[model samples]
Target: MKTAICYYSRHHGNTLRVIEAMAEAGDAELIDVTARSAVRLEDYDRVGFASGIYGFEFHRAVADFARKYLPQGKPVFLVYTYGGAKGAGAKAVAKIAEERGCPVLGEFGCRGFDTFGPFKLAGGIAKGHPDALDLEDARKFYRSLG
Candidate 1:
């Protein structure tokens, strides 16, 4: 089945690394939310919403994309990269998907380098994270979703 990943990867580009790895294995398209509008869900069989945590939430652009477009009855999933595990970007997106009548197939996350403002002062916690190992795991995870 065809799939698409709609996301925003700012600050560290960590989320994109994971999503790109996944896309390589899955027949999925990647849409950078900053560079495009919400995509037509009918073009794909499934959708994945991915992004980095920002201010304890999903990136504003991703949130807006979800709010603006989420196809009805589509299978959806979420992936996020975060500095710490406490944030709820994945949870928030999952809720949005559910509310939109999309069945959530699965969700995944990886620890990523953090460079959001003060987080960069320390040269990024989890430096070099979302590394090759993480990318491989993400690809495996997405493949399983198929």
Candidate 2:
């Protein structure tokens, strides 16, 4: 399947690592959501949104990118990485897909090193995460779908 993943992987590039493994598994395209121009989602058979969890959600840019350019009626998926796994990032993206009448294939997330706020004081958390095992799981998740 032709897939495109719109992503915003800042800071430690945790989300990028997972997506890269997914891309390597198939002919998936990576569209940076923070790019200068918007991506046209209709170019692919499947679409995905990915980012690191921030403030209990995905980076605002991802939601904005989807709202601005996501086409209607396409199969969508969600991928995210975060220091703390508890967040609404996937839920929000799934809502967007539902609103556009898109069938969600699945959502996946893995632990990522983080030091955004309070955690910074302690150096970081979830260090060495999204490691080999996580990448293997990510690959498995992608293979489970298209």
Candidate 3:
């Protein structure tokens, strides 16, 4: 399948690890949301939106992309990485995709090293995360979509 991954990975690039592994496994195209203001979904059969959790939500730019430009009636998936396991960024993305008439194929996420704001005080949790096991899990998740 022709797939495209739209993602935003700022901080320590923990979230980007999963996206990268997924792309490499699937041979999907990768679109960095920071570089591209909006994604044109016409080029791919499936679109995956990936991001790091920010305050229990997907990043503002990613949310904006989903709201303003994600194609209607397409199949989409969500991939999120967070320091803690309690957030709903993946659920939020799935909800947005559904609202846009896109079928949610699946979601894949995991706890990644977090070193932002308050978390910085302790150096970071799960340091060096999005580790080998997480990457393998992500690869499997992407493969399962087929």
Candidate 4:
């Protein structure tokens, strides 16, 4: 299927790394929400939202993009990177997709080196993460989407 992933991966670029690995493993279009305000998804068969966890949610840009542009009943999936936990951001995004009548295919998440907030004072956490193994796992997750 032709897939498009709208994502926001600022700070450490951890989310970007995972998204890149997934795209490399399959035919997918990567959309940086920060670079573009609006996108047309009618040509894509599936849509994905990816972001680094920010305040226990997907980045604002990603959430806003989905709210504004995601098509009704489109197949949707989520991928995220976090320093402390997983699923929170995915759940939030999934809810949005569900409300739009999109069937959520699945979700994938992993640790990304986090230096945000107070963690920066302690030299950060999950250092060196979204590493080789994490990237491989992302590729596997992408393959599973088929």
Most lDDT-accurate candidate: 4
How well is each residue in 55-113 modelled by candidate 3, as lDDT tens digits? 89788778777777687898998888888853667767788887878998988888888
Model 2 per-residue lDDT tens digits across residues 1-146: 78999999997999999999999887799999887495678988999899999888888898888888878999999999989755676787788889999999999999999988888999999999889999999999999995
Per-residue accuracy of model 4 over 72-121 as CA lDDT, tens digit each: 99999999999986546777778888899999998899999999889999
Q: Which ten residues in a row have the lowest lDDT in candidate 3?
A: 85-94
TM-score (all chains, Cα) for each model: 0.92, 0.95, 0.92, 0.95
RMSD of each: 1.4, 1.1, 1.4, 1.1
- The whole-model C-alpha lDDT of candidate 2 against the native structure comes to 0.89
Off by over 4 Å in 3: none
Clashing pairs in 1: none
Overall lDDT per candidate, in order of appearance: 0.84, 0.89, 0.84, 0.90
* Candidate 1 lDDT by residue in tens digits, 19-112: 9999888777899988884468777888899998887778878877877887788899899988875366677777877788899999888888
Global Cα lDDT for candidate 3: 0.84
Q: What is the lDDT of residue 71 in candidate 3?
A: 78
- The segments of candidate 2 whose C-alpha lies over 4 angstroms from its true place after superposition are none
Itemize residue pairs with steric clashes in candidate 2. Answer: none
- Residue 114 error, candidate 3, Å: 0.9
Candidate 2, after superposition: displacement of residue 144 in Å?
A: 0.8
Residue ranges of candidate 4 with Cα displaced over 4 Å: none
Task: Indicate whether candidate 3 or candidate 4 has the larger lDDT.
Answer: 4
